[model samples]
Target: MRESRFIAVKLISVLKPVIDRRRRLALIVDDTLMARSCSKKTELLAKVYDHDKHEVLTGYRGLTVGWSDGNTFLPVNFALMSTKKKENMIGNQPVTADQRSIAGRRRTQAQRPMNAVTVELLKQTKKVYYRYRDRLYDVKGLYERLAAAKTRQ
Candidate 1:
């Protein structure tokens, strides 16, 4: 994961010059369904709603945050959200990874609510790129958290 982040940062630096100076950078947050309907044993697989399809589906919600300047878009951070409710989960195998390991941490994070995970993705994005003129997130409580973060700094 750290390696991927490093690559994303490098990619951003390389692309920064190509972005139009007249346009402001914005943070965009959104989620999509990652269908794993056939897999019963996949880790963290859950029954998630597909807003586009307007129905429940067997999959994970891939929440992502990205940076965009009218012309170009670069993904900054993301989280795969899984339902914590046992009834909604399709895969319930216990996570055996050590708590300190990245895999374990990520597995734990997957079970958290989507809004909380989205906030975490925003925080991670903020660490990588500090300047953005606008934030495009639909989650409730996100503005409050970001404002609180700003006040702390």
Candidate 2:
């Protein structure tokens, strides 16, 4: 099936007011992993990476994202974290030495953090969806980055 067009009800300029009024936009950031092509169950392996010089524990991971109602949990956003999981994402050395241990590298990746993803996800939530449960339909047009930008403004 083909996805439809996404219309952002809230504009970026107005988001600050919405957030300030409610204190928070009700966001939750997490990971979820779908099976990679031609792969079975997820495995725990310290796979050597081409980009980063060290091996990372690769269980074919992604983010399990959603949102919360202060005291309650409701899924609003689900952004699959970039699995490349590099150090440049963090304020650390952009290179890794093969001589390094898996523990050392993963520590760096974890430290890199997902603050950017969190921010973008929240923004996407406000822009794309009017209400959480109300948007079970696939949003369109937004898949096109340039088009989405025009709508956000």
Candidate 3:
């Protein structure tokens, strides 16, 4: 995750020159299903609802947040989400890593609700691109969840 952030920071620097300063920038958030239908043993694999297909499927939900200036779009950060429900989970192995370690934290994040993860992603993005603090748009219904996550911290 640290490596990915480093790369994203560098990419932003490279793209900054091309992005028009006059136009409004947007912090886009969305999720998509990464289907793994054939693999039953994949770690953290779970039953995720595919919005496009309108059905539950065996896979991970790729929750992503990106930056765009109307024309150019650059993905800033993402989390692979997994179902927390015991019955919906497919390959739910015990995470043996230390809770403070990246792998353990990532596993914990995967099981969290999408709104929580989205808040975290946005916070991380804010840290990376501090200049665009005002540009981070809150998705409808997420303000309450964001406040809850902050109080827990």
Which candidate number would show the highest lDDT if scored against the true structure? 3
Model 2 clash pairs are 4-140, 5-140, 6-140, 30-64, 31-63, 31-64, 32-62, 32-63, 32-64
Off by over 4 Å in 2: 1-25, 32-56, 85-113, 129-153
Q: How well does candidate 3 match the true structure in TM-score terms?
A: 0.81
Off by over 4 Å in 3: 133-153
Candidate 2, poorest ten consecutive residues by summed lDDT:
1-10
Backbone clash count for every predicted candidate, in the order shown: 0, 9, 0
For candidate 3, the 10 contiguous residues with the lowest summed lDDT are 132-141
lDDT tens digits by residue: candidate 1, 71-142: 777777888788778888788655664688878878888887776677677777777777789998754456
TM-score of each: 0.84, 0.32, 0.81
| Alpha-carbon runs more than 4 Å astray in model 1 | 138-153
Model 2 Cα shift for residue 50 (angstroms): 20
Residue 58 error for model 3, in Å? 0.4
Residue 104's lDDT within candidate 1 is: 81
- Evaluated against the true structure, the overall lDDT of model 1 is 0.77
Order of candidate numbers by TM-score, starting with the best: 1, 3, 2
**Full-model lDDT for every candidate:** 0.77, 0.38, 0.78
Ranked by lDDT, top first: 3, 1, 2
Per-residue CA lDDT of model 2 for 1-153, tens digit only, reads: 001113123232344444444534444454433334433232222222332323433333343334443444445554433333343222223245243876454444433334444445556666655443321212212235424454777
